[model samples]
Target: MVDLYTHILPNVEKGPRDVNAFLTMAKSLVDQGVKNVVASPTYNGQDLEKQNIMLYVEAANKHLQHAFIPLTILPGQKVTIHYRLIQAFEQNVHLPINHSTKYMFLQLPNENTDVLNEQILYELQLKGIVPIINEPERHPTFLEDSDLLYEIVKRGAIVQLSSDSIVGKNGRKEKKAALTFIDKGLAHIIASGVCADTYESYTLPKAYDMVSRQFGTQILYKFMENADYIVEGKAIFKEQPERVKKGKFLGIF
Candidate 1:
């Protein structure tokens, strides 16, 4: 399986802290049946590694090869949303998934202004970058007002639901929101969080199974295939996003 959002890079904030952690993460992913990963490290926080992401990917690939781990690492970055995201990409300050210019993993701020969020989402798409917003289910803004999420996705920004959210690791509220997003056609991709570790390795398969059981195999396949497309820098699949009705998920709000 291809796990798009991963932190297996050594020393990157969410990746293994050292050589031992690196091997441990590699084995954990392999054990979880993941054959490929996009080595996405968060860059917003002070300690998160933003530059030299390719170097991290290289070191991780080398480690996997030497250690006989079967997982392959791809270059990626997780950036917090801001007005300058497009400029940053143009400056080559951060990487898109698999080093492609097509897709990026975007993390929404905890506090969101609807106008600003929509504008950035629109502006990113205009720059030919599909901002795949990460884990909207767990974000307070989206949790309180699902329409904001609906409109952002409607404007062509992709949604990446986290596996932890789907499997109830984040909480029941997030899990409910994740499933509802799928049901409402508001979410396009599902992946592990930017931080990769042994504890998270098991959630992907379980999320897949849960989604398949609830929504059938085709939706499952679409999510899986979309991940591959992002890696190849190609267009992603999408269904017309429908507004998640108000009060449908009030408990989460």
Candidate 2:
């Protein structure tokens, strides 16, 4: 399974202890049996925004060589916001992406609606780049107004929810929002936004199980197809099961 998003700092190589700490954290994810992890650099509140993304990408690749089969680089939002985001579109030039990479991951401001985010996505689409937004539910504004989620999907952005949100690790509200979006068919993928060793948080496989039980096994495939198409630059939803889950269950008498 492909666990989508994580924040592996680039400056971890600053010292021996730092390198060891990062490897230990990364290996823990591998120990949990993840096949591949797509990671982006964090940039919530920092002076060195996008300063360490390149290093993070390099670190992910290095760790993946020994831990997983296919290491995917989720271009941190700092990279997107600072450069490479609207470059070709803004300049009207055709540029080829790095030979090894295909997709870019971005984070939204906690307080903005999907409108500005859509503009960014449209710019990316115009430039022929597929942008995947990370953890939309974590955005305070998005949570306050769920309809924005549907609107974002209406535009060309794929929404990734954290695994912890899926199984109620974040809270009942987060879990409900996540499931509601899934039920409405808005959310496209589940990523393990792992920060540290926390047993209460949902792992990728466990989240998959919970989603399968709540929705269906077929939705899982649809989610994967969404990720694949975005990375592959496809503009259509992959063919899916015609039958959608119906008939809610009630507690036993």
Candidate 3:
């Protein structure tokens, strides 16, 4: 399986501190049946972080070769959303997923959807890059305004659900939101947003099981296939998202 979102790059962002820490995390991922991992360190309009992540990927894969683990690390960045996003991409300041320039992993603010600039996303799409919103299920604004995600997806963006959220590792509310995204068909990808310190490495498999049990094996298959497609830099298949009703209970607008 391909893990599209992860912070496993050593000494970069909030990922592992050293090579040893990264190796430990990598072993955990291998144990969880992850054959490919996209080393997506946080990138907020910076080039140095992306360089560091690449350096680490090169080193990590070399070490994994001797470790006999059948895993390959790829380049990616979980870029923070900003109004200058379009300029950053145009200037080649921010890195896209695997440097493919076709898919980007965008990190939205947790507080509200007001910070999201739909035009920037539209501009990226116009340039033939698809912005995959990272962990929208954990954003408070998305919980309060679920239709915001539906509208974004309708406008040619994709939503990536956190594996930890599906397994209730983040919290109950995030779990509910994750399930809601799946039930509504708003989620196109299920990613192991694994951090070496906080998130459990095995949760990705657990999430696949949960999705299979609740949503069916077909949905689970598509979610997993999307990860592979992202790694291959191919077009992803997306189910039509149903519009979420507003004024629902539990602030699920």
Candidate 4:
């Protein structure tokens, strides 16, 4: 499965010791059967953070062109697109894309979001860029406003649900919200936003398997296949044969 979201800090030195902490974390995932991972930088880092991201992007792009299952780098950050981003755009500091990098992974604030978030997405759309909000389950405000979530998808923004939510790693509240979104067909993708132990933690294969066992294989497969599409930059739509109700489970497959 393609892990659509991850964080891997680059190693500045050579060999294994040269890489950052997250690389060691990611190495564990590789041992667990995760073939591809789309990684990005953390919100905070020191010098050459941008350069590190670029290195990952450039390297991955070259490998992907040859069908090599190299770890892919999405490179965009979690921070808001403020003066710095705008200035970078003005100076063309961002990586040039070819109809693909149009999709960006946005990390929303863990707490409630204001109208500015909506504006940020709107502006991104205006620039022909689609914002894929990561881990909506962590944001309580989103669960409180399902209509707003629907609106975001309606306006062409995609929601990425974390795989751990199904197994309750994110806590009961996040699990419930994730189920709500999936049962209602509001979620289009599920990724193991795993940091460490690729084999043990954030392993999509195991997490989804457990979910399939409990929730039935159909629900699990729906998210599994949809996850593939999201990584390929395909648009996923809500697929419900009937209306969804709270506290009720729907057949997902």
Which lDDT values do the candidates have, in the order given? 0.81, 0.56, 0.81, 0.59
**Model 4 weakest lDDT span, ten residues long:** 9-18
Candidate 2 vs 4: which has more lDDT: 4
The true-versus-predicted C-alpha distance at residue 168 of model 1, in Å, is 1.0
Per-prediction TM-score, please? Answer: 0.92, 0.71, 0.91, 0.71
lDDT of 2 by residue, 146-242 (tens): 6665666666666678888877777776777677667766677877766544523437778888888877889877776665554444553623212
Candidate 3's TM-score reads 0.91
- The predicted structure with the larger lDDT, 1 or 4, is 1
Q: Which parts of model 1 are misplaced by more than 4 Å?
A: 45-51, 194-201, 250-253
- Clashing residue pairs in all predictions, respectively, total 0, 0, 0, 4
Clashes of 2: 0
| Residue 75 displacement (Å), model 2 | 5.5
User: Could you give candidate 4's per-residue lDDT for residues 80-187 as a string of tens digits?
Assistant: 344244345445444322225566666665554556667777877788777777777777667665666777777777777887886778788788777767666677
Error of 2 at 237 (Å): 3.7
List candidate 4 segments past 4 Å from native: 11-27, 43-51, 56-76, 81-99, 110-113, 197-199, 210-222, 237-253
Residue 148, model 3: Cα distance from true site in angstroms? 0.8
Residue 218 of model 1 has an lDDT of 97
